[model samples]
Target: MEWVFWGLAAFCAGLVWFLLKIATTIWRKPLQVKKFSEAQGISGPPYRLFSGNSTDITRMTDEQNSKPMALSHDILPRVLPHLHQWSKSYGQDFIFWFGPNVRLVVPHPEIIKEILSTKFGNYPKPPTDPLARQLLGKGLVDLKGEKWAQHRKIINPAFHMDRLKGIIPTIVRSGANMLDGWSKLILLGASEIDVQKEFNDLTANVISRTAFGSSFTEGKHIFEMQTKQMILAVDSFRSVYIPGFRFLPTTKSRQRWNVEKEIRRSLRQIIDARERTAITEKSGRYGDDLLGFMMSESKEQRRVNVKSNGSLSTEEIIDECKTFYFAGHESTSVLLTWSLIYVTRNEKPETKPFNGNGFKWKLALRNGRLQGETRFTHRNAKRCCSVAFLPMKLGRLSIPAGTQLEIPILAIHHDPALWGNDANDFNSGRFNEGIAKAAKHPMAFMPFGAGPTICVGQNFAALETKSVLAMILQKFSFVTSPSYTHAPLLLPNLKPQYGAQLIFCME
Candidate 1:
């Protein structure tokens, strides 16, 4: 009887504590962050308790997602309606709330250069959306300070020009295989096909071979699981983020967890096999591919963690695999898919009149083959962001720590002030002088980003994209399919809502 009384009292005490904590988070902290921003001349859509701007965001996204857009190059309105609308109303560097957290939108190139340029000394990435962290792990994209530097240092040499050169043949081979499949499809009277889907498979194959020494077919299961997890992570799993809601025994949650577990298990097998082969072969080396580079004894040089041999933990190595495949594979695929969209729509593949972009090749079909040079648009017009871990001076404003920041790459890319009147139009001719000379600001055309955190796989992706595009051009000429719907939306990266459907005619 006495035990029951104490138990009830303890239960009441815990319930009170939990309620107080929620109150502080949902009400108190938001007021502090909002007040701090208002003092610095920053403002946005007024914050609503618990919901903040999430309701507005969800409403806008739902509206856009309901239908496809017309075939046009201006994608900002369709892809990121929330950022687009708010940036116009609140100026380029205003603040908004994602739930209780105040997010500062930073779109100007002058300021973008400063934020990404610094070491993780002051600005570190915001805590990743919980679902995303589960999908990608705490790899390079999420790691901070010394740990980031350590992992990056070990992985750097694998992307060196020399190391990447060794993989060019692999890219070429993979592209050829994909092109062969397209030829067979054309022969079988399937002239109208989705190039976006094809490019996704092509890039998957490219990354698998480079990262794990396996072809897409060899690691198809692994890629499939990661794909499912990425979709879930970016979709409803990240909606509004209720504190204890995800841990609920929901059907969707269980499925997501199962997929994630399978991913780690599959990756472990590959790494273990590679290590065993290295030991048995007496080569004292893992191959020269990315994984091989990470597993090498001499490569790391110093012990990053307190492991026996002073190398990266197997877990760290696995996380990086997820990052490279997710980041590199997805971005490059988006680049190729959009490049196809731009080129096919151009109607002319010959040299466009050079304004500033040196020489230009619009998509032209001659003698049943594509002529002229092939270049890929790394220009994502993408959206990603970071947070201020400590108070830092951003241009004129002294932003405080805990400031969440979003760098609107898409908005910056298409801003008329930066890219002239034809900013939104599909003009690959802009890169004629090279990316730097192509835009008003040096950081303006950053398809792969800039500064220290600029994508290490940039060179790898560019080469693969060109290689694949060139091969496809040699094989076929494509135009927009009549059934195609141009609905470019960001599933964390710019993607066609209905998939990039195009019609391939014999070149």
Candidate 2:
């Protein structure tokens, strides 16, 4: 009887302790952190019990996204309503919570420089969530330390201007094929077209052929799976993230897993076939495509046995492929879509073929459309786990570990202080002297990203946009259709929710 009493007492204490632990983690610690940050002059929406600011963010986002926005360059409020609202309430640099986690938004340029530059050592790239890991893998964006350096070195050659220029003919060919279909439609009295869909298919076709060579069809299927996987992963992440629960056999998880498996299997087959070709070919070359550059470096890494450049394993290669397909396919397509919107809006439909110095193109990129938040689609950005890895001093404040840092690209790009009074309006002349002089600070114009880790495929994207748009301008003139609705959706990136409808006029 005495032993039983003692056991019951112990069990009760254990249960109480467990409850306390949950309470402390879910609310108490976050409260303390909030107080400390407030003491440091940083304030945000008051932290809630467990959901924190996520509910507020979701509400604001849902409400804003529920309607059709007018055609204007002032899209920051519609796309990132939470950030737009909070920044107004909490000043330029503020902290917000995402499900009990503290996220610090750094919008000042000096601080952004500190975060992205040499002090980059203090701030590491956040880890990818389960689905994002499947989407991007251990590619350049996710890699760190020597592994990242090695991968960067290997990937450098593929995206080099010379190499990118080599792919120009392929881009022109792909664009021409898509345009030919559009021409047929115009001849058959289909004057109106959804250019958004056209660019999506065009960019997809371009990436498939350029990245995979002879295996483009297989690459397209793999990218399609990744697209489905991204959707499932994002929908699941919109709710509070559970640490180990993603492994369970839930419906969404099962869907994500199925798509991920197909992506991996398809990518693996394509990679293996490429490798076999490299081995069998008498020249021992992997061809001049993106995959070939990595494969060549991989072979060299194995041969030298240096271990310093780091090893590129087979799985790593697969991840890189998925990353490339995801990033390359969508970002370029959205860029082209928005660029055309500005082009058709600002200039006459009969405007001549776009030149390198085309004001509308520059305005599209410079006025916070492409240049604002091209990298920020895919609402699962939280997976990057952008928390402070350790207690670190940022500018004037010393933030604790687990404090997430966000460089709000959209906020910075649309700041009136940086770009004068017409910040939200399309001002192509602002960029006449060049992007550096366009804004108060050069870093304000971060379309691809900033720091040592700026987007590697920027040249590819830029060249493709120029080639594809130039080809279109030469073939047909287009005006915004009356039926077109301007609803910019930001869940997976800034996209036209309805579709960018344009009425094509034969040139």
Q: Each candidate: what lDDT?
A: 0.71, 0.77
Give the clashing pairs for model 2.
377-493, 378-492
Q: Candidate 2, after superposition: displacement of residue 102 in Å?
A: 0.8
lDDT of 1 by residue, 1-507 (tens): 999999999999999999999888788877876777778877788889877898898899889889887676666676678888987797777877777767788878887777777433456666666677787887988776678777877777888887798898989988888878888889999988898898888888888888877523546678778889877666556566677777677877888899888988888887788778878998867776787887783234544444634457888888888888777887778777877766665654333311212212222111001111111111111122354234556688866666666776667777788878877665555766866876788887665667777778877876786677667666677777778888777666777788888778666
The sequence of per-residue lDDT tens digits that candidate 2 reaches over residues 224-289 is: 777778778778777667787877899888888888778788877877887788778856787677
CA deviation > 4 Å runs, candidate 2: 1-6, 231-245, 250-252, 348-364, 367-371, 375-391
What stretches of model 1 exceed 4 Å from their correct place? Answer: 1-24, 214-218, 231-241, 248-258, 297-310, 348-392
Candidate 2 global CA lDDT score: 0.77
Cα-based TM-score, every candidate: 0.83, 0.91
